[model samples]
Target: MATIDLTEATFPETVGAEGTVLVDFWASWCGPCRAFAPTFSAVSENHPDITFAKVDTEAEQGLAGAAGIQSIPTLMVFRDGILVFSQPGALPAATLEDLVSQVQALDMDDIRRQIAESEADAEVDAGS
Candidate 1:
């Protein structure tokens, strides 16, 4: 599948949907972002089941800011409406592929349990 351009309006629904969604936050002016575009697009073609989307930082400043995008080439991976991985920088094709493998292997139920435990711990600490 070709990478889709995500806007502030479409961002929520797209990422919150079921399955894996890979979002690349980028800007045309950044050299690293330009370098990563081809790799991102190529990987998207290979993973037809995954939704690969791009957010142009310059065009969608509000969305980018809301997403905490401090860098031009930030990659955020979401699975089953939960953010599984997020990082900044241009990733090589091989590394990106490996990341996809890792995300696919994750046990989301365990992840959710951990999140709930952490939230509960935070709440307990706040009550102290």
Candidate 2:
């Protein structure tokens, strides 16, 4: 599938969708961002089940700010409408592929259980 152009308007709906979503935060002025574009595009074609979205930091400053994007060429991964991974840097193809593999292998049920436990712990602490 092709990468979707993400803006502040579409950010909520797209990221909140129930599936794995990879968002590339980039700016046209950044040389690394330009270089990583083709790599991201190539990887996108291999994963039809994953939704790849691009947020143009230059054009979508509000969205970038909301996402706390301090650097260009940052990558954010969301699974089942929850953010699972976020980092800064232009990763090589191998690294990107490894990330996809790792994301795909994640046991989301376990993750959700952990989150629930943490929230319950937090509530107990708050009551103390």
> RMSD for each model, in Å, please?
0.7, 1.0
Model 1 reaches what TM-score against the true structure? 0.97
lDDT score for residue 39 of model 2: 96
What is the lDDT of every predicted structure here?
A: 0.96, 0.94
Q: Please write out the lDDT profile of model 1 over residues 5-102, one tens digit for every residue.
A: 99999999999998999999999999999999999999999999999999999999999999999987999999999999999999999999999999
- Worst 10-residue stretch by lDDT in candidate 2? 11-20
TM for candidate 2 is: 0.95
TM-score of each model, paired residue for residue: 0.97, 0.95
The segments of candidate 1 whose C-alpha lies over 4 angstroms from its true place after superposition are none
Model 1, 44: alpha-carbon shift in Å? Answer: 0.5
Error of 1 at 103 (Å): 0.4
State in Å the error of residue 128, model 1. 1.6
